[model samples]
Target: MKPRILYLATADARGHLMRAQLLAHALIERGAEVEVLTTSDEGATFLGEFGIAAEVLSRHYAVQFDERQNMQRGATDGNVARYLFDPRHMLRDIWRLRRRIAAVDLLVNDSFHPALLVMGCLPGWRRKIVHVYGASLRRALLDNFQGRLPNWLARGFAAAISSELRRARACLQHDFAYAAPARVAPRLFNLPTPIALAQLPQQVQGPRAAVYLNPHFRDPQLATGLEQGLAAMGLQALLVGEGYAGRAGWTPRDPQWIDAAAHSALIVSAPGMAALSVAQVYRRPILLLVTDQPEQRSNAARAADLGLVHEVVCWSGDARLFAIQVQEALQRLRAVAIEEGADAGSQRARQRLDAWVDCLLELAAEPR
Candidate 1:
C-alpha cells in the first residue's frame, strides 16, 4: 500500500513552499499519496505555478516583514502571541490538524506553521512528524532572542525550541552549499537542499541573466535599480517576482524558471536558499541582492565565506546609488569565467533526496 503523506508548509517565505513542492513531487513520482497544506494564499498560488495543488490553511500566521523585506520582530511577536493565545481559532486549527493526521501515514512539516508545531509536540502526533527546514531558519529563531529578550525569557524560548525538536520523529536541516551530511542532534540530520536535479532542463548557455525576487520584497526602487543596471550592461534579462507582474520590462512567472536559470550567463536574486541551491546545482554564477533581513544577510555572508557567490550587492538606501552598485557588480560578475564540468551539486542533491525519502518510508513503516 502506498503511504499517504501530509506536508504542512509555512508561507513566511517562498523557500518553504518551494521545498514542499520539490519533495511532494518526488514523493508522488515514488507512488506516495501526498497532500500539501500551506499557511497563506500566496503559498497556494506559488505551488499552483508548478502545477502542485495545495490547500490554504484557515488559521493564517506569518512572520511580519517590512516593505523593504526586513523582518519586523515586534509586529511578528505580537501576531504570534495573539494567534497562539486565541483559543477559539488556535484550538480549531489544532483540532482540524489532529483529525487530518489520523488518516495520513506520515506528516512532513516544512519549516512548519505554529499550529503544526504545537500539534507536533502533542503526545501522538510527534511520532508521525518529520520536520524539514533550512539551517538558516534555525539560526534565525535562536538569534531572535539573543540580547533582545530577558535572560529568563530567552532560556524559556530556547527550551521551547529544543522541546519541540525533541518531540519530532526526525528533523532534516538543509544547507545552501555542498557539505558532508551529518547527524546534528538526537533526531536532527543536516544535508544539502533536496532539489530535483532531474527536473532541471538543460539549456544552451547564453549571455543573459535570470532575475527572481520573492513577494516579500516590496522595494520599488530596488526593482528599478535592477532593471536599469541590467540595461546599462546591455544584457537581456527576464525579471519575475511579486510586484512586477503588470510593470513594464518584467516577465510573467515562467514555470520553466529553472531552465531559464540554467541557460543564463548570470543569475540574480535575493539570498534565498532555493535560488542559491539552484545556482550551485546549475554551476552558474549568482549575484545576491541582500536586504536588511537577518536571514538574507546571514545567507549572503555564508555564501561569501564559502566562495559560492560571484558578487554581492547590498542596498544603499538610494535607488540610483544601488543601480550604480548593481552595474559595477554585474560588470565584475561577467568577468568571472564559469567552468564547464560535471554537475556535482546536482549529484549531491539527488543522493540527499533518495536518503530523505528512505528515511520517510522507514518511519512510516514502523509499527505504531
Candidate 2:
C-alpha cells in the first residue's frame, strides 16, 4: 500500500496553509498520498490552487485577523471569552480527527486543533511531526511568565508541553530564513522548488514592492500613512492581505502573492513565517514591522540579528517616525540588492529541507 500522510493545521492564517501546501506538494512528488485537514474555507481555496486535496475539518467563527499576520491576545476579548467558555468545541474537533488517525502513516501538525487535541491523546498516533515557525508555546511562556501564573505553574505547563515535544517524531522549526531543529529533527525551512516559483503567476513588470500587513491589530491610519509613504517613494506597491477591502488602491489577489514576492524589490511587513520565507527565497531586503505580540517581537529581533532583514521598526512610534523609517529603508534597499546574496542562502535552505524530508521517508520505510 502507498504511504498515506495526513496534515493537520489551522487554516485561519495563510502562512500555515502555505507551508503545509509546499510540504504536501513535496510529499506527493515522492509518491506519498497526502490529504490536508484545515479549519478555513480560504485555506481550502488556496490549497486547491496547488492541486492538493484539502478537507475542511472545522468552521472557525472567531474574529478573523489579517491572513498574513498572527492574532494578538486580548485583541478580541469577547472572542477569547467565547473560546474559553467553550473548550469542548475544540475537543470535539479532535475527536473527529482521532477517528481518521488510524489510516495515516504520519501526522504533520502546524499549530492547530490536532496538535493540542489528537496528538495529546493517541500518544502513538502515527509518527507525529510538528512544523513551527514564529509564536510557539515557548514564546508564550516567556510572554506570560510575569502574570497570574506563578513560576511553578509556568514551569509545570512548560514541562508538560516539553514532554509532548519529545513525543514528536520530528519537529521542523521554520525560522523563515532558516529552520533549526527544536528537538528531534534538525531545523529546516520549506524552501520553494524552482518549479514551484515557475507555477506562480508571471511577475508583473513595474517598479514593484510587496507590502504585507496583518489586519488583526492594524491601525487604519497607520496603514494608510505607510501605503502613502511607499507610493510617494516612486515604487508601485502590491498590498496582499486579508482585510482592507475599502483601503484605497489596494488590490485583491490569491495564492499568487508568493509569486509576487519573488519579483518584489523589497518586502515590508511584520516578521511572519511566510513573509520571511519569501525574503529568504528571493534575497529581498525586509523592512520588518514589530507587532505588539511578544512572539512576533521576538521574531523581528531574530530577523534583525540574522542580517536577513535590512531595517526593523516597531509600531509604537509616532506616524512621522514611521514614515521616515519606511522611506529610509526603501532608500537603503534601492542602494543594495539583497537578492543577489540569496542564491547561496537559498541553496543551504533547500538542502536542510531535503534532509528533513529524507528523514521522514527513511523513518517510514523502517519496520515499526
Per-prediction TM-score = 0.93, 0.80
Q: Give me the runs in candidate 1 sitting further than 4 Å from their true place.
A: 178-180, 184-186, 198-206, 341-349
Candidate 1 lDDT = 0.79
Q: Write the per-residue lDDT of candidate 2 for residues 77-188, one digit (tens) a residue.
A: 4553455456666666666767776776766776634334336434566354544434443455444544647888877766665566556555544455444433333423
Q: List, in order, the clash count of every candidate structure.
A: 0, 3
In terms of TM-score, the best-performing candidate is 1
* Model 2: worst 10 consecutive residues (lDDT sum): 187-196
Candidate 1 local Cα displacement, residue 283, angstroms = 1.7
lDDT of 2 at 143: 45
- Model 2 residue 309 CA deviation (Å) reads 4.0
Candidates' C-alpha lDDT = 0.79, 0.61
Writing each residue's lDDT as its tens digit, candidate 1 over 252-354 gives 4666776677657889998888888777777788989887787777788888777675788888778898889999999998888886543565576688778
